[model samples]
Target: MNFRARGVFTLILGSFFVSGIAGLVYQVVWTRYLALFLGHTSYAVIAVLAAFMGGLALGNAWLGAKADRVTRPLLFYAGLELGISAFAAIFPAYYDLVHQAFLAVVRGLQPTGILRLSLQFIFAGLTILVPTVLMGATLPALTRFVTRSLAELRGKVAALYAINSSGAVLGVVLAEWWWIPSLGLHLTLFIGAALSFAVGLVALILSRRVEALGDGVAPATVTSEPAEQFTPRQLRLAVVAIGVSGFVAMLYEVAWTRLLALALGSSTHAYSLMLATFISGIAVGGWLVYRWKRQAHTLAAFAVAELVLAFTLFVSLWFYDLLPWWFVKLAALLARSDPAYFLYEWLQAAVCFGVMFVPAVCLGTTLPLVSRV
Candidate 1:
């Protein structure tokens, strides 16, 4: 690739890595650490996860809607970096404070279960909203930075998505195997925050240079028909499909974990494996979409994959305990003879392949179609 191409590619890849680590820190490390310290009540962890995702979706929608008017995308990124840094720097202290507060509440009036749960939800929501919202703006901002033409936009977007997903896989492996276990959650968050800040600084400097070289011309904005212009039926269909696929994929993943946990008689490990598998599937699906050329056919293929994924989830849910006798016997034998970590790992792989692959393929294909429209 030429120099500009190379530069854009590097930025995308670096952002991918940083964003991936940030997500891992939140989803895997922070959630586990908080639950461990705060008690595993669904009120605590699930509330936090929902808050983060909700903030992320809202942030993405906001950024995408106003992307064209944003003259200083780098500044937004810098703010994200600063926000993350502040959050990380305070995490240890904040957790301690929250824990102390929880204890005080328990001691004082002895709140009902519902009241405690409400408190947990509020606390979790405030703690996670900032970083998640910042992260949500990233892809749209990066898309604005890298895209130079309507024709090339889809490929550029796909490349960035693929790199980020790949980074997510690495982040999961590293966080689980090394960071959380060795460095601890606080330090891991700090490291991720530092990386995010560094990337922002670099992007800021580079963007300045690009502006200088352009002799005052700003970066080109994405060309799309205004919202006031009615979207054609095909475009509407594409958007609906993408949204539906994404929602179903997330549901399938959660269901898969619950099913596996029940079958395997282990909840925590089964959940982790499901998450890792789903992330890996997204990475693989992204790469495949990046390589695929025919947009219309790609969409069709993705639709088929979504159907398969839905079928798989339905079957798994319906057949929750009906595994062949030999399979259960084999599991029991392995559990008796050795640690059953391998079983969870294998199940994780199966779940990853089934749950992640199809919807990811479908989602990946949608961007290209939208860009084409």
Candidate 2:
């Protein structure tokens, strides 16, 4: 990359990183707030994730379809960031209002479990849909804005995703270990808002500068690359496979989370550690994609990764059966130790890592590879 290309890449990467941190901050706090309102059940977690991911899927495809058409995508990205910041600033209050409204409406009717869960999901979905959709658009907007040449497009997208994933790792750790503990959810939300607003302003300024630089020049071309040169039927099949991959990945994540809670004590720190490890694996996978993009075969690598992931999932059951015996042995070994609880927590985290890390890493590789396709 030349100096100017490198400069633009750096700015895009940094902007996305800031946005990623703010986005995760909102996710962490909002999910906790929703859990409180809806009751801390497995269904509640699923509801929140479904709402969030549903918004993302819609927004990603919606914005991605239009991203390349805009002459100044950075300005569009700036608008999205600013809007998300505004939403974050008011979300806690909005959530409370929505929760109260839901309760009042359901007071006369003792809804069944399934009905109640559906109601809760609707309320949560309304609360998060707008901001989360905007969050989902960031990748496409940045990808569109940063790719000045066809040769650099794949690498640019991969690198941007890797940077954002790395930032999410930081966000998860900080929100768990520091932000929620130190600032509380309300304050943390505002802090995230500030970060997001800052990114918006920076993007806006950069957009104007770039526009001026290209004042007399022809517009930069945007390529509309299809997933791959497959028959329409094959393309349809690939889409179905991608959907299945997403579903199975989320299913495994939910299962692994519950398993971790069982093996480790159901402590906040334990949950945080598990989440952090999962995100770290994603960051590693994105980095690998960017670092080895030239050598990577999207379909072949994804297929092998999926097979390995399935094997790991099966093998994990055998390890799960052994956990009780090992925990018993560890507890007995540390019976007289003052920091026995701490030691056990660490061991539990290690076990969780061992069981989930390889699969999570494989799951991570799928994103950038799919992006290239």
Candidate 3:
């Protein structure tokens, strides 16, 4: 924690923050683009989404292993970011190719509903998995780069994740408010590419500086962390909790969006804003984790976070009954002061915050604590 070390850590956090923004930008836009190609049916949309997440899972599983093993984790992270930018640049063309391939499958086979769904998934997966896999690898690489020892992981990973999620909050805001609305999706893709490229270049430069400065830390020092002593039972429980954490988070997002749409309207703004609210809560929770600076009791903390999250989720169901009343009251307040549809943004946010923020924060807290394992 010397001056030089702190400076280097700041640079790394800054890089992760930038990457977080670019990642969410890509995700928001990708859903739009994927929906166009895959159609708007629930089944089709889910298929495309599953493909998107599957790629990330694949990357986390595969490259996460390589992250600590790599001699230079910054280089590994930079490569992933650069690869994401490169693939994003070409993704439109790649998407069209996949679309053509999908149509050929339909025309040639004349597949039924289930077969078509499978085909949609296959085609969508083929189109998106490359860049997303790279995106997924980033957290592991960046986390490894920041933590030179098992003990160093205590709050560091969560703080890094917080910075990243903070960027994601802005990313969602930018895409919704300016990027898509101003530049259109195609041009927005280029903007995202440029962001990825910028981060990659920064990382590459930092890597060289680390070499020249010696940095008081070897490039390979992360690999020298003492072995963990978690028992088989502890490891198994932690792994299960990680899976459950992801599942519950995803379910909350999907459910909250759908439920809110029922209360609010189905405008694109509601969807985007709800998503932003979710990420913001996560970002807040991450900050809380770093600020708490408590010991890392991965199992106990993870379990408590999950339990609180579940209770919150159940409590939210009761709150749904009150949304109608809340909206009516909100509308009345707006009506008094010369309301406009644009003003509904406030309403959307109030409703989203009411139910989602706390649970999302819990979702944020769990990952960091559990990752200590």
lDDT, candidates in the order shown: 0.62, 0.76, 0.79
In the range 28-86, model 3's lDDT, one tens digit per residue, is 78777766776763333355457667878999889978987987888888899999999
The TM-score leader among the candidates is 3
Preferred candidate (lDDT higher): 2 or 3: 3
Task: Kindly list the per-residue Cα lDDT of model 1 for residues 1-373, writing each as its tens digit.
Answer: 4666576557657776777766665666666755665466333445655776687788789865565457765555556666766776677777778767767766896777788767766666666676777777787777765665554566667777767766777777776667877997777777777777777777667667764365222333434632222247866786887777667655665555455554443434344555666666666666666686553454456566666655655665555565434346555555533347656456546644554455455544544444444
TM-score of each: 0.81, 0.89, 0.90
CA deviation > 4 Å runs, candidate 1: 41-45, 64-67, 98-110, 215-231, 264-269, 295-302, 315-319, 323-328, 331-373
Candidate 3 off by > 4 Å: 41-48, 212-231, 296-298, 321-339
1 against 2, candidate with superior TM-score? 2
Which scores greater on lDDT, model 1 or model 2? 2
Alpha-carbon RMSD, each predicted model: 4.6, 3.6, 3.5
Task: Order the numbered candidates by lDDT, best leading.
Answer: 3, 2, 1
